[model samples]
Target chain A: MRIRERIIETGLFFSALSSVFITLGIVIILTYESFGFFKEVAIVEFFTGTTWMPLFAEPKFGILPLVSGTLLTTAIALVVALPLGLISAIYLSEYAPHRLREMIKPVLELLAAVPTVVYGYFALFFLTPFLQNFLPELSGFNAISPGIIMGIMIVPYVSSVSEDAMKAVPMYIREGSYAMGATKFQTAFKVVIPAAFSGIAAAFIMGISRAIGETMVVAIAAGMMPNFTFNPMEPVQTLTSYIVQVSLGDVPHGTIEYRTIFAAGMTLFLMTLFFNIIGFWLRKRIREAY
Target chain B: MTRSAIELKAEAKNLNFYYGPVHALKNINMPIERRKVTALIGPSGCGKTTFLRCFNRMHDLYPHNRYEGEIILYPDKINIISPEIDPIEIRMQISMVFQKPNPFPKSIYENVAYGLRVRGISRKGILDEAVEKSLRGAALWEEVKGRLNSLAVDLSGGQQQRLCIARALATGPRILLFDEPTSALDPTATSKIEELIIELKNEVTIIIVTHNMQQAARVSDYTAFMYLGEIIEFDKTDKIFTAPSNRLTEEYITGRFG
Candidate 1:
């Protein structure tokens, strides 16, 4: 019996260790390549310079266009997502009857389960053309269509998380609000939403991170122009899309161009880490407020 | 004074409630008097809570819960069962406090001011006066006045419960319901809440559901003994404790059976 327990404990230990090992491996690889890239190209020029002419005779390694593109897409996706997601969450958690909630919650979950690649294909083939007819200036592969589709894909995440947060609010709080003669909408908006704000904020940050890290949809629907434009109607290349573009092309191994992908990957990693930290801090502050 | 002078503030006539096919409350007929505390005492699942919840239409908040017969609020001539009566409006006249202290995640002052703010009272002086008055009414003003800006959850359990009372009082309801309000509290907090309920009887008609027979005897002017969704006996508090009319009320008061 002791030997069996020891074996089970050892298995559990190794499983936990493997996760730490994988994270350490990613950090090491990102830092090593990032260090090598910075050695060749000045860190200041890489961060501040606007142009990214990597294949030219004299490569100008400016990463701002890629960062700006990522930010623009993320902003567009959030603008499309936040209000709709919150309202749907409120409907699901507060308004929907038990039978309807049982039916609708699973359908929303299924949306999250759909492959990101399928969303990419749908955005490219169906949505983009549908939009081009109305907006004649729309490009074949613009950020607008893909960002909107990506926003739709992310809606389930925000809604589900926010619903859980709203549901976790104590029943007595809603009762107290109702006892004061507040309507259902008022109770949900003023009392429940404020109480669940921290959790909803965390959900928003997670959705933003998902938008930033998404690759397939942006790669297929948003063209690899790497332009420093903020307009969603124009083609742009995000960090994830740039990585995909570089990996698909014939770039020599251990070259500066190849290392630049790792640099971009490092930037993505840091950006998400920054968002997670802020999200965690907000959650902590709200919890402490209670 | 004659029976006519004793106004029937609220009357439930042959009221029945069902959860799906299960009968939760059956043929409950009771008359609540004005400016008095009526204590409903029973075991868990005896339907005291369900009956109390029906007063404010809180039962409608759940799905598959249905009610039969009528609950009438006198003077207003409002049959709460009527479709024209808004549930929110009914709740404004009848407020409730739960067994657990549920202060909103806000400052002590804000918790009291929430109901007033909902009513569109925006002036700082009005809110400040209302908060102070409500807190004082709940017997919480002296303890919480200095730290009114502190989060309510930071208070002790007893203080938080008083803060909840203050919050309910801020709405200025005609009736107040307590569903085992002292059940989750410590002995000292229980006494404090009991004292506050007795004090509040002059301003609002109070209905309390309690498992503690001694608490019911101490705080109420009238006592209702319930069993299996029916009121077995109801009389003056002194008479119910000393000389109950029904054998079931006697058995329950003497700890013979729940």
Candidate 2:
């Protein structure tokens, strides 16, 4: 019996360690390639230069345009997802009737299950054309449509996580607020939301990170032009899209063009890492608060 | 403290409650006197807590919980059970402390001030004063005075319950219900809460449900013994403890089959 139990425990320990091992492996690979890329191009030029014309003459290694594009789409996605997802979470956790909640929650999660490539096609083929008619200024493959679609795709992440956090709050706290004469809305917005603040903040960060890491939709719908402009209606090339652009072509291995994708990947990795750190800190702070 | 019996704070008439089809409270009729601590004592699952929650219509939180009959509040002359009467308005006048100390994840002052803040009392000075007064009323002012902005959850279990009391008190409710408020506390904390409940009666009408017969005897002015969703006996603490009314009440209080 003891031997069997030991074997089971060992199996469980290794299973848990696999996730950590995978993360470490990715970090190591990213760091190794990033180091190789940095040895060729000056780090300052890669970061500070505004132009991202890596394919053209002189092959400028400026990553600002790529980073800016990434930020633009992520910002748009966050703007759409955060409020809509939070409201949906509130309705699911607090207000929606039982049958409605049961029916809608899975459907909301189904959005997450849908392939990102499908979403990319929808953004490129359907959403852009549909939106173009209303606003003539919208380009054929603008950042706005893809960003909006990416936001819709990631809504499940925000809502499901936030709803779970809100649900984890003890019922007695809500009862305490209600006993003090707070209305349903007041209790939900004030007591429940504040109690679940850390979780909600973590959810927002996770959603933002997901938006930043998203590749397919931006690759398909957001144009390959690395314009550093803030206009959502115009085409822009994010870090992920540029990587996709290079990978799709027959760029020989060990070339500067190939190395630039590593540099961009490192930047994207760092940005996501920063968000994850914030989310971790918030989750830690809330653990102390409760 | 004794007050005029005629000056009833709340009265229930044939109150019956059901969770779905299962009847939880059966024909509960009682009067809660003004400025008196009334203890509802019974075995587990006897509907004592349900009866207490009915005072503020807390069961309305979930769907399919049916409430029959009327809970009348005096001075306001309001029927608490009527659909026309808003539950929120009733809750403002009658607050509750739970079996477990469930303070909001906020500072002590904010927890106390939450009730007032929800009612739109935004002035900093007014909020500060109310926080101090409510904390003092709950007998936690001296201990917590040093860190008014410290998180409520940082405090001890005893202090958390006191914080919850302070929270309820800040709303300036006319009645306070304690649903086994000291069940999760230590003996010292339990005694402190009992004393606090008695002290609070000078300002607010008190309705407490307890499984401890000794606690009910120690603090209550009026004691109601409930058995299987029915009030087996209801009388003054002295009469209920010393003499007897129902044989079932006697047997149960004397450690017979509950």
Candidate 3:
């Protein structure tokens, strides 16, 4: 019995330790490889320059176009996800019948479980054509289609977390609102949402992080040209998409072009890290509040 | 004993409540007098809170919860618990303070302004006047007047409860329901709430459910002792406290058994 217990404890310890070590390893490698790239390309120019034709004869290495693409897609995704997620959360938390909520939540989450690569294809082939019927100027491969699809892909992350936050608001607070004659909509918007603000804010940040780090959908649907424009009608390449594009090509391992992926990976890592920190802080604050 | 006829605010007639298969309140009948305090006192799970919530149709918020009779509001004569009557309409007239200080995680001003906002009262001058008046009514104006923009949760437990009372009063509700409003407070906070309750009954009709017998005696004009989902006795507060009533009421009052 003692030996079995020891074995179980050891297995659990290693399981937890392995995740920490893996994360540490990723960070170490990112910093080391990025260091090599920064030595070859001026760090300031890589960050601030507008052009990004790393493989062209001229080889400009500005990251802004990729950053803007990531930002543009992320902003568009938020436009779709924030309202859709919060409204659905309110419905699930306040209005939907218990059995119905139970049935719908898992089905809604199954949206997240759908392979994101499939979403990429859907965005490219289906959504782009469907959008073009109305938006005559839209390109065959544009950020708008992929950005909207990415938004739909992340609705579950935002809605599920937000619903849990709103639900975690004590029933008594809701009763107070009802007792004052506030309708369900008023109570949800004016009282429950505000009460659960920290958790809801954290949920928004989680959704943002997921949108920023998403690779497959944008890689496949958002045309791989690194264009430095805000107009979603034009094709653009996100940092993740740039990395994917280069990784697919047979760039020699130690070349400056290959090292650019690591540099881009580090920037992506930092952007996500910034939002995750905010999410973590907001969650921590809420823990103290309740 | 002879007594004057009292003007009634509302009454529950043959009210039976069920939580799924469990009969929580059975055949309850009671009168809530205009601008007076009616206290419900009983042991835990005796359905005191359930009875208080029924006045505002709070039972409707949950699934498998049913009310079989009527809680008729005065002047309007609307059956508060009727399925045909919207609970929101009943709630607009009747407000509640809870067992714990459940403020809306908003500023003190917003907390008081919430009921009015629900009624679509948004002009700044009107909101300011109403907020001040309601805060004064709840006896919290002097302390919170300086910092109306601060969060209600930042207030002390007792102050938060008063803020809730102020929120309830802001819309000039016809009746106020308090469900063990001081159960989570310390003794000093409890007395402040008790004093506020005494002062509040001069305006809106008040119904409070309390576990403490002495609280009912101190603050209520009328008291009902409930046992096992039934009102064992209902009379003047002094009469219920000092005189003979049902055997169970007396036993519970005397702490012989719940």
Candidate 4:
């Protein structure tokens, strides 16, 4: 029995250590490769230059267009997801009957399970045509359609987490609100939401992270032109999409062009890390407020 | 019984409650006097809290929780527990302070002003006036007056419960229900709450469920001894404490068995 216990303990230790090692390995590789790219392309120019003609004879490797593309899509996605997610979360947590909640939550999660590639086509073929009818200036491959689709894709992440947060709020607080003659809507918005604000904020941050990292939907729907514009109507390329474009294409190994993917990947990592830090700070502040 | 002279705020007539198949409260009949404290004393699972919750139609919040008969609010003469009556309407007139200090995660001022805000009273001056009045009514104004914008959860446990009381009072509720409001509090907090309950009865009718017989004895004008989902005895607090009554009430109050 002791031998078996010892074996299990060792197994678990290795499993935990493996994940740590893998993460450290990725960071090391990304830093190493990005360093190689930065040596050829001036760090200031890569950040400041507007044109991203990396494959041209005189390659300009400005990251702003990709960054703007990411920001615009993420901003649009947040605008769509935040309210819809919170309202749905409130409904599920406060208003839905047990049977209804049980039935609906799984269906909402199933939206997340639907492949992002499928969502990409849905954005390109179905939603784009439907949206173009109203706004004639809208391009066939534009940021708006993909951003909306990405928002729809992330609803489960936001709502599921937010609902769990709302549901975790003790029944007694809600009871206090209800006993004061507050209706379901009023109690949910005024009491429950405030109580679960930290968790809800975390959910919004999770949605933002997912939207920023999301590649396929934007890669397929938003045309991969590195356009330095915030307008959702125009074709734009996000950092993730740019990395995907390079990695999929034939770029020779160990070259400056090949190293750009690592630079983009590192930037993406930094952005997500930045948001996570903000989420951590916000949660602590709200908790202290309580 | 010279019943006609005393003003009654509400009455539970043959009230029965069920949680799914379990009969939680059975054939409860009681008078809630106007501007007086009525204490329900019982052991755990005796359904005292269950009985108090029925007054504000709290059972309606859950599924498979059914109410039979009536909790009729006097003056209005409305059956509060009836399916036709909205729970929110009954709740507007009746508020509850819970066993634990379950203050909303909001500022002290926001907590007190919540009930009024729900009722659509949003004028800043009116809110400020009402918040102060409620805080004063709950005997929490002096300590919290200076830092009303601070988070309510920052207060001690006793203060939080008092804030909840203030929150309930802001609506000017006709009745206040306290379900073991001090059970989670320390001894000093418990005594303060006891004093507050006694003082509060002059304004709104109060119904409190307490496991502590001494609390019932100290704060209540009237007392109901409940055992096994039934009220074993109902009388003046003095009479119930001093005089001979039901064998079970006698045994329960004397700390022989609960």
lDDT of each structure?
0.89, 0.91, 0.92, 0.92
Best-to-worst order by DockQ is: 4, 3, 2, 1
Each candidate's interface RMSD (Å, one decimal) is 1.5, 1.1, 1.3, 1.4
lDDT of 4 by residue, A236-288 (tens): 99999999999899999998889989988999999998888887786676554
Ranking by lDDT: 3, 4, 2, 1
Colliding pairs, model 4:
none
Per-residue CA lDDT of model 4 for B1-258, tens digit only, reads 469988999999999999999999999999999999999998889999999999898898888999999888999899999999999999988999999988888899999999889989999999999999999999999999999999899999999999999998999989999999998999999899899998998899999999888888899989999989999999999999998379888888889997
The TM-scores, one per candidate, come to: 0.95, 0.95, 0.96, 0.97
Worst lDDT 10-window in candidate 1 chain A: A281-290
Candidate 1 on B1-258: residue-level lDDT in tens? 136767778888899999899998889888889899999998788999999999998977777888898889977978776557788888878888888888888789988998888778889999999999999999999998889998888999889888889998988988899999988899999999999999999999999999999999999988888889988887889999999989989998999998
> Lowest-scoring 10 consecutive residues by lDDT in candidate 2 chain B?
B1-10
lDDT, candidate 4, equals 0.92
lDDT of 2 by residue, A123-218 (tens): 999999999899988999888999999999989999999998899888888998888888889889988999899999999999999999999999
lDDT of 3 by residue, B190-235 (tens): 9999999999888889999998999999999999999889998999
**lDDT: worst 10-residue window of model 3 chain B:** B1-10
